[model samples]
Target: MSKVILITGATKGFGRIWAEAFLKRGDSVIAAGRNITALEDLKNKYGDLVLPIQLDVNDRKASFEAVNKAKEHFGRIDVLINNAGYGLFGAVEETSEEEARNQMETNFFGVLWLTQAVLPIMREQKSGHIIQVSSFLGLITLPVLGLYNASKFAVEGLTETLASEVKGFGINVSLVEPNGYTTDWSGESAFQTQSLSVYDPVKAGFKAAVSAPGIFGNPEATANVILKLVDNDNPPLRLLLGSFAYPAVKKVYEERLEGFEEWKLVSEEAHGA
Candidate 1:
């Protein structure tokens, strides 16, 4: 059966790749993005299989309206891929108030609004899947991506809670945590805060970390994994993409566990009578 999948940020990166993959497999796609013109080729090639909508995910009203429009046109939305977010690069002290709020507005609140908008529709259907494109940074952290990490960490908490809440309603929530990808996420799509000379060393170290060999994965390779994820009857709550993600997250958790063990006496004493 052909599914109706709504994808945000469909203008480029993983969003566009996944949209094309779904369309090629005879699924209907509501490709929502700020750059509707960029999706013209997909619209032309896929014909009615794809609907390109101009959207800035920061607008809560527009987010709800997009969901309603997709539901009306497609009769139902079987899957929603919330891939509409960008990276903010700057050290904690270097980030401005405006930059911090904007990052959360789009990356965290955008996901919240869209997820809220689709809940009623999916609840009514008694079946649907919501995929959030988080990052390996969500589970850990880095020097220059402090704000970006906070946003994804918020997403991680939100989606984990959502999965538990929606399980009984037949709504599946999955967080697609990818490590660095060879996408424009860190290039054209990224926003860099005004730099301070004090943070230059921190920024340089961050740059070198990302530029390391095998740190990034091909964005195209993710389509099949996404397709299978939605098709599976028992999907994972958190699906880590790329080779770097698992090992990286594994190391972080190991350190976290060690810290917990070291503080076990204090932790137990704090809760004691």
Candidate 2:
């Protein structure tokens, strides 16, 4: 059966790649982005297989309206890929209140609004897949990416809770945690805050770390994995997209476990009468 997949941030990068993959496989796509013009080629090439909608995910009303429009156009939504978010680069102290709020508004609240809007539709259908494009940074932290990490961490928590809440409704929710990809995520799509001289060394070290060879993955390679995820009857709640993600997350989790063990006595005492 041909599925109807709605993808946000479908203008370029991973979103556009995945959208094209779906269209090629006969799955209809509702491509939502801020730039409708960028989507014209997809519409022309794929014809009715693709529906481009102008949307800025930060707008809650627009997000809901976009979902409604997709439903009306396709008659059903089999999957939703919430991929509309950008990276915020700055040390925690260097990040301004406005930057932090804007980061959350789009990266976190955008996901929330769209998830809320689509729930009713999926609930009616009794089956649907919701994939959130998180980051490996969601599970671990880097110096300059504090706010970005926080945003993705928020998404991780939200999606995890949502999975449990909607399990009875046959809704599948998965967070796609990818390591640094060769996308414009860190380039044109990213927002960098005012730098602080105090953190120059930290920033320099962080820059060198990210520039390491094999730290990034190819975005095109993710389409098959995504296809398999949505097609599976029992998809994972968390799917790591890049090769770097697994080992990176594993090391972080191991350290976290060690910390918990190290503080076991204190933790028990805190819970005591």
Candidate 3:
């Protein structure tokens, strides 16, 4: 069955691929983005099936307006993919307060704002799916991408709580934790901090090594997994995309568990009598 799917950051990368996949599968798409030209091109190709709406996800009012417009155009939104975010590459000390705040505003709060806007309508309908595009960094962490990790980690916590809160309303929330993909994420779309002499060696070594080709997975495969999640009646609270994502996250969890168990006696002894 065809449904009305709204995707933030639908202009490029995973969002664009997901939008295309849905449209090709006969679903209507509300392609919301900051880029007018790209959204227009999507509309031209898909015609009425694609409703290209200009949306700056950072603005609360704009998010509300976009949801309203989606309702007006498609009558109801069956799914909302919160795929709008950029990566900030820098150590915690390297990133300015403004840069950190901007990263959080766009990644964490933007998802919150848009989800808030769409929740009321979904509540009334008693059925909806909210997909948050988090990264594997949300589960683990990276050296230079600390700020990006912070934002996605915040998203992970928020979406987990949201999933529990909205289950009564028949609204499902899931986090898509993807590893590095062949996208513009680490390229033109990424933001970097001014290199400090202190961390230059660490940055130049490990970061450079991982930024090579073939390590990143394909975006289309990730999108396909998401489509399956959308169609699922009882979807998971978290879905890790790409081959690398699962094993990497699993290792993180195992290591975390080991540390916790090792410290169990010390942690328990610290509790008040």
Candidate 4:
């Protein structure tokens, strides 16, 4: 049976790749994005397999309308992939309040609104999967990516709580933590603040690290992982994509646990035990 998959940010990068992959697998796709021309192109290429919608996920009303449109066209939405976010690069002090709020609007609040819109349909069907395309930056942090990290961290929390709340309805929520992939994520899709000399070294070093050959994983591989995840009857709450993502997140959690154990006595005494 062909499943209905709805994806935000479906005009480019991982979202586009995921949409194509699903369509190739005989699935019906509702590709939602802000670009009408790109969406039209998708429809032209995929024909009836793809229903392209002009959707700006930051607009709450638009988000709801897109979901409703998907449900109406497909009659059911089996998967909702919240992949509509951009990276905001700059030091915490360097980014302005407006920039931070814009980042939150698209990366955090956009996910919330879209998920809220889709939940009712999924609840009625009693079977659906919500996939959040977060980043490995959500687990760890980079010096200049503070704002992006904050947005993804918010998503991490939201997806986790949502998973618990919707489990009884057969809705599976999963956060896909992808490491650096060969995408426009850092190019056309990224936002950056004016550079400050104080953070130049931090910025340069981080750039060098990620730009190293073979450090970034394949975007196709990430899409493949998501397809397998959706096919499973029991999916995990979190799925880390790429070889580097799993090890990197594991290291961060290990360090966090070690640090917590070191402060166990002080933490315990805070309760006046």
Candidate 5:
């Protein structure tokens, strides 16, 4: 079945690939991003099937307007893909508080606001899927990408809770945690601190390494997973994409579960029966 899908940050990177993938699958997509010319180009290629709506998901007003426009176009949104997010590399002391919070605003709170905006409509219709594109860092803590990890960790928690909340309403919330895809996720898209002397030398080294392009998993492969997510009768709430991400997610789970078990007695004692 074809569905109306909306993706944010569709001007470039994996978001753009996602838009193209969905459109090829015959899904009506609301291609949203900050770049007008890019969005216009998409509009020309896919014509009416691609609704290139300009959006910066950080703005509450613009975010809501995009949702409303998508609704107006398709009558309702079948899938909402929150893929418009970025990473910043800096230590806690090295990066300004303002920079850290900005990361959260885009990766964490922007998702929250957009999810909230779409919920009521999905609920009323008794159907929809919300796909939050978090990174493998969402599950595991990265060295210099502390702020990025922190924001995605929050996204993981939020989507977990959201999944349970909308179960009865027949709305599904899916999280896609990718390792690194063929996106322009380089230093140009990143912001770093002027001073890196605050953190230890190892952290500084890690921070410096992030400025260059690392091994990137294919965006098309990731988009194929997204297509699966859309077609499934029962999609998983959490999915780790790519060979690189699968192991990382597994390690994160094992470590987290072990830590919980090791500290279980203390937690149990606190809530004495």
Candidate 6:
């Protein structure tokens, strides 16, 4: 049986690929994004199978209406892909309060609202899949990318709690953690604040590393993983898209485990005293 999938950030990257893959599987999809032209192109290419709607996921009312409209199109949606997020890369101190809030608004709150709106329908239907487009940075922290990392980390926490809570209701929550997949992430990764006083010395080197090729896995690869996830008999709670993400996460896990053991005495002493 074919499924109905609603995806955000359909203008480019994973969203677009997901849209194409779902359609190729003969499923209906509602592709939502901020770009009208891109949406139009998707519509032209996919015809009625792809319903392109312009949306900025940050708007709660718009998101609600979009979900409802998608429901009207296909009668029901089996999957919701929350992929409309932007990155802001800079030191935490270098980022303004407004910038930080913007990051959370788009990445965290936006997904929250959409999920809340859609979950009721899915619950009523007794089954659905919610896919969150998280990142490798969600697990490990990098020096200069604190602002962006913070957004994804919140996503990790949110999804972790929600997945357990919703399991009994027949809804599955899955997360995609991908390595830097040659998308517009870097260009869109805003610099909340810039100053020679802060990044002057090593700025060039940082820029070089960031702009390097093969920094991320292919977007189509991420899309294929998502497509497979949709049809999975029992999909995993989380999917790591590239080899790069696995080792990085393993390092974090081991380090945290060792650190906990090393600090066990202090922790026990504080609790006991």
Query: Which stretches of candidate 3 lie above 4 Å from their native place?
Result: none
Per-residue lDDT of candidate 5, residues 123-205 (tens digit): 99999999998878887876777888899999999999999999999998899988776666754677776566656786767
Q: Which residue runs of candidate 4 sit more than 4 Å off their true CA positions?
A: none
Please give the range of 10 consecutive residues that has the lowest summed lDDT in model 2: 239-248
Ranking by lDDT: 1, 2, 3, 4, 6, 5
If scored against the real structure, what TM-score would every candidate get? 0.99, 0.99, 0.97, 0.97, 0.91, 0.94
Clashing residue pairs, candidate 5?
A: none
lDDT value, residue 227 of candidate 6: 78
Better of 5 and 6 by TM-score: 6
How well is each residue in 1-273 modelled by candidate 1, as lDDT tens digits? Answer: 999999999999999999999999999999999989999899889999888888899999999999999998989999999999999998888899999999999999999999999999999999999999999889999888999999999999999999999999999999999998999999999999999999988878878887898788999999999999999988999999999999889999999999999999999999979
Query: Ten consecutive residues with minimal summed lDDT in candidate 3?
Result: 206-215
Clashing pairs in 4: none
> Pick by lDDT: which candidate is best?
1
Q: Model 5: runs farther than 4 Å from truth?
A: 198-200, 204-215
TM-score of 2: 0.99
Itemize residue pairs with steric clashes in candidate 6. 180-216
* Model 4 TM-score relative to the real fold: 0.97
- Clashing pairs for predicted structure model 2, backbone only: none
lDDT of 6 by residue, 212-249 (tens): 66666777676667878989868888898886889979
Better of 1 and 6 by TM-score: 1
Clash numbers, per candidate = 0, 0, 0, 0, 0, 1
